[model samples]
Target: MVCLRCVMVVKEELNKLGYHYISVVLGEAEVIEDISAGQHEQLRTALLKSGLELMDDKKSILIQKIKNVIIELVHHSEDPLTVNFSEYLSQQLHYDYTYLANLFSEVQGTTIEKFLIAHKIERVKELLVYNELNLTEIAYRMHYSSVAHLSAQFKKVTGLTPSHFKQLKDKRRSMLDEM
Candidate 1:
């Protein structure tokens, strides 16, 4: 689950199954009652049918947690991080950065840096479509060193300059899950 609507869907499905959830956050949930084996299978099947999966493997769960952290940072947080992203991730997930990076690359077939860049670029696209902030402000919000750097990355990823992209008739942005 990467967005509020996804959370809502998960909650709806859980309620339909008559489970009382204590909380449902991105990529995780806790129900008041212990889940039986059959209930667990039912929940897994229901989530899968709704385009969500109940991940059980440790590696897969860790990968999803990493993705969730990045998504929350890029899409939900307003303030930039005080520390480096690597350090923040290490502290948040309670694992060494190297281990996390290697596991992410091994499971997702992409480095964590590239994955973060992709999500950041998607957020940039969203801001451009909204037309609420200029490039410099976006750079600041996104923790880029400068506007030029942001523009170069935006062009490299999208094949168009920021200004050109903004002028596009159909501004395309990827869904968070797709990213």
Candidate 2:
């Protein structure tokens, strides 16, 4: 789950299955009772239908947690991270950076840095579409070293300059869930 609506869906599904959950966050749900294999399968099926998945394995859960953190950091955070990405992830997840990187690469088939960059680019797209801030402000807000760096990365990802993209009628911005 990446949004409040997704959390609501999870809650509704749990209630439909006659289960009480303590809470449902971005990537986790805390149920009041133990889940049987049957219930687990039902949940997996329900979430799959909603374009989400029930993570069973520890590694998968961890991977989802990592994704949730990145999503929150890129899309929702007001303050940029004080530390580097790897260090922040390490501190938050309580794992060494190397292990996290290797595990993420193995499971997601992409480096953590690449994943973060993708999310950052997506955020840039969102901010550009909103037109709330200029490129310099966006660079500062998103923690880009310079507007030129941000522009280069944005162009590399979207194949168009930010100014050109904003000028177009049919701007393409990806949904967070799609990413």
Candidate 3:
């Protein structure tokens, strides 16, 4: 789960299965009661019907949590930290940065820093499409050190300078759903 709507869907599925949940966040949930195997299976089927899957393995669950945290910070949060991405991730996930970085790279086949840059570039595309924030402001909001840095990264990732990308307004920006 990476958005509020996803949380809503999960909550609705849990309720439909007669399960009580205290809260449903992006990647974690606190249920009121322990469910039996049959109920768990039913809930899993319902979630799958809604295009969601129940993650059961510990490593997979942790990876999902890491993804959720990054997604939330990059695309949803209003006031993100000014700190380094690794430090932010370490604090948010409550794990040593090195261990988390190694696990992320091993499981996802990409370094966490690269993953973050991809997500950040995607967010920059969205903001450019919206035309609400100027490049400098977008850079600041996205935690880039400067507009030049943001533009360089954007061009490197998308093969077009920010201004060039903005000029071709008809280009389709990728959706979070597709990411």
Candidate 4:
């Protein structure tokens, strides 16, 4: 689960399955009662039908958590993180940064830094599409050191300059889940 709609779908599925959920947050849902195998399977299938997966393994769960953290920070948060990303991630997930990085790379076939860059570029695209913030504001909001840095990274990732992307007739932005 990476968005509010995904959380809604998960909650709806749990409710349909007659489970009392304690909470349903991004990438995780907690039910009050212990689920039997049959119940779990039913819930899993329901989630699949809604285009969501129920991760049972610890590693997969951890990966999802990492993704949720990134998605929440990039797409949802208004304030920038005061600490460096490595320290923040390690503090948030209760694991060493190296372990999290290795596990993420091993399972996802991509480094955490690359994943973060992809998402940041995607966010930049979104802001450009919205036309709400100027390039400098976007750079600051995204925690980039300067507009030149943001523009360079954006050009590298999208193969188009920010102004070019904005001026095009068909502006394209990727879905959050797709990223």
Q: Could you tell me how far off, in angstroms, the CA of residue 143 lies in candidate 4 after the best superposition? A: 1.2
Ranking by lDDT: 1, 4, 2, 3
Worst ten in a row by lDDT for model 4:
169-178
Model 4 Cα lDDT, one tens digit per residue, 30-147:
8999999998899889989999998989999999999998888888887878999999899999999999999999999999999999999999988987889999999989888899
Give model 3 RMSD, 1 decimal: 5.0
Please list the residue runs of candidate 2 whose C-alpha ends up more than 4 Å from where it truly belongs after superposition: 169-179
lDDT of 2 at 168: 72
Model 1 spans > 4 angstroms off:
169-179
All candidates: TM-score = 0.90, 0.87, 0.91, 0.91
Q: Tell me how many clashing residue pairs each candidate has.
A: 0, 0, 0, 0
RMSD per model, one decimal: 5.6, 5.5, 5.0, 5.3
Q: Compared to the true structure, candidate 3 yields what TM-score? A: 0.91
Q: Candidate 4: deviation at residue 1, Å?
A: 1.0
lDDT string, candidate 1, 98-156, tens digits: 99999999989999999999999999999988889999999999989899999999999
Candidate 3: residue 116 Cα off by (Å): 1.0
Model 1 lDDT at residue 123:
97
Which 10-residue span in candidate 1 carries the lowest summed lDDT?
169-178
